[model samples]
Target: MSGRTPSTRLADTIGARPVSASAVVYPGKVWDVVSEDVDLGRAGTVTREIIRHPGAVGVLALDDEGRVALVHQYRHPVGMTLWELPAGLLDVEGEPPLLAAQRELAEEADLRAGRWDVLLDWVLSPGGSTEAFRCYLARDLSPVPEADRHQRDGEELDMPTEWFDLDEVHTAVLANRLNSPSLVVGVLAAHASRALGWSTVKPADSPWPEHPKLR
Candidate 1:
């Protein structure tokens, strides 16, 4: 009744594939793997191990100066300290994604945004893992005072955050220099949304069923 009407109901299209059995194969600090016997229409039933992730949120913080904030931190899995947007895991039970994004932006980058909206949602390596992400576009930024900023530790202690012009981020995306999925998608989506007069952006509290938590 307010902005854009909700789209078609996409649920129940695919009937649930009967899960005969499931068991936890491994459990880690962040995620858990469970093996399941899943029914396949023509292929019969098959056993598969799926990684269950708690989901994540990425914040594309942009200042009124037209600069995008970025952070450089070590990614142990890839053995490289890559540049990325302010992001974090959604491990807290019952915490809304928008609130999580707000907390992450403040904690990781010492920044705050007055306006927030859904940029995009994606599933990374859906074949093996349930690592889904919701990226938010944050604007009208303000810097938190150094004295009041959150204390850092681990990789965060050494992580450096900086702002780059929108053109610079776009160029980096085109040059394939920025490898983080969240950053790349955020940049492209932000560019496209702006071109469309920001009509594509949804409210910060928009429902996201693809974000694993709701699924």
Candidate 2:
């Protein structure tokens, strides 16, 4: 085949032994047990490992008014109130990332988008565990007629959903009002879309805001 010879690929399953494991410090519905272990390698050597993970999702919902939806929530970890996009943990078994984004939008903000596109995939924290974040951008939006206040995993989230102009959101970020990555990335992506004239395809009655909040 085109004078190319395929070299044989060798595969091996090296045996490993777990010498010891540390007790989990935190346990949750989806992920549990922060742990450290000594894994004895096939070469008769042991390596210490530690892992901690809590997967999550984030969504940027764009409304026809040239505004982006944001949620104001109290984050206990940072001990402060922060504005963020609709997001939550991927707790459902075999739930697709896009589905999770849709669910999170409805659950967190009582909203949905006519068109949803996944824009970026990233790791929330790579230094510790195998937690990943899937960022999404939603355009042509519609709010859910009814909001279900039920907490998915018994986690209490007292947050209010509000819409801000794209410029306002970007300004809020520079002013430290919107500091979350999802919001930042979403706003940027939407702005890029606007720059490329993607917003013009919609109805002319509602035009993209000319003055983006420069912060």
Candidate 3:
């Protein structure tokens, strides 16, 4: 047998904490707060309060010219409009994450892509929220006529969107100019993917078991 201990091998495996008991402590419009007692083998049981989320999707739309499409919209939480990639929530009933990404790209940027690849996936805050994110790299883009665009409201109304060189976006990500977790991860991941000739990119329909909504 290998020198790795059983406990170490188990940690390397994909595992789920068996839920001994769970209940919603608070229900809200966007998410619900839930308390759960989980059983962790070899480590006694523990209770945790989780923000049950439906998850979300983001797009890094790249044109053939190597420009990335971005949007400037005000986020009330931060009290500032941020520069971010086209993105949206996965709240639509029965909608898959990839489809949500496509819809968001069109809605937020008035654009679409002929090809798409899964750039990366991540959990926003495992300790607090069950929010998972999938950042897609959209290539060979085209414009959606003004008439075909999704109507906007509030912060998104009259939003300003533009295309920036991927290299510049990558630099912003490194310099913390574009620091939203989704944008940062998406831009850097896209740069790395392109460097590998997209070998690192997974098919648009690739499995995303990390999103709690799926579970």
TM-score of each: 0.90, 0.66, 0.90
Candidate 1: what lDDT?
0.88
Number of the predicted model whose lDDT against the real structure is largest: 1
lDDT of 1 by residue, 1-215 (tens): 57987768954242348899999999889999999999997999999899989999999888878888999988888888788999999998889889999999999999988999999888888788878899999998888888889998877888899889987899989998989888888899988888888899899988877765575
Candidate 1: C-alpha RMSD after superposition: 4.2
Model 3, 2-109: lDDT tens digits are 996577555323457899999999999999999999998789899999999889999998887899888987777878778898898899999988889999998888
lDDT string for model 2 (1-215, tens) is 58967656553232335656567777766666565565646565444333444466788787878787888887778887778888987667667556778888888888778886665555554446556666677788876775444454433356778888988877767776666776776677667767777542333122212111100
Number of colliding residue pairs in each model: 0, 1, 0
RMSD of 2: 11.6
Ranked by lDDT, the better of candidates 1 and 2 is 1
Error of 2 at 107 (Å): 1.3
How does model 2 fare in lDDT?
0.66
Model 1 residue runs over 4 Å out of place are 1-16
Give me the candidate number with maximum TM-score.
1
Cα displacement (angstroms), candidate 3, residue 6, comes to: 20
Candidate 2: which stretches are off by over 4 Å?
A: 1-30, 33-51, 147-157, 197-215
Off by over 4 Å in 3: 1-13
Distance from true position, residue 166, model 3, in Å?
A: 0.8
Q: lDDT of each model, Cα atoms only? A: 0.88, 0.66, 0.87
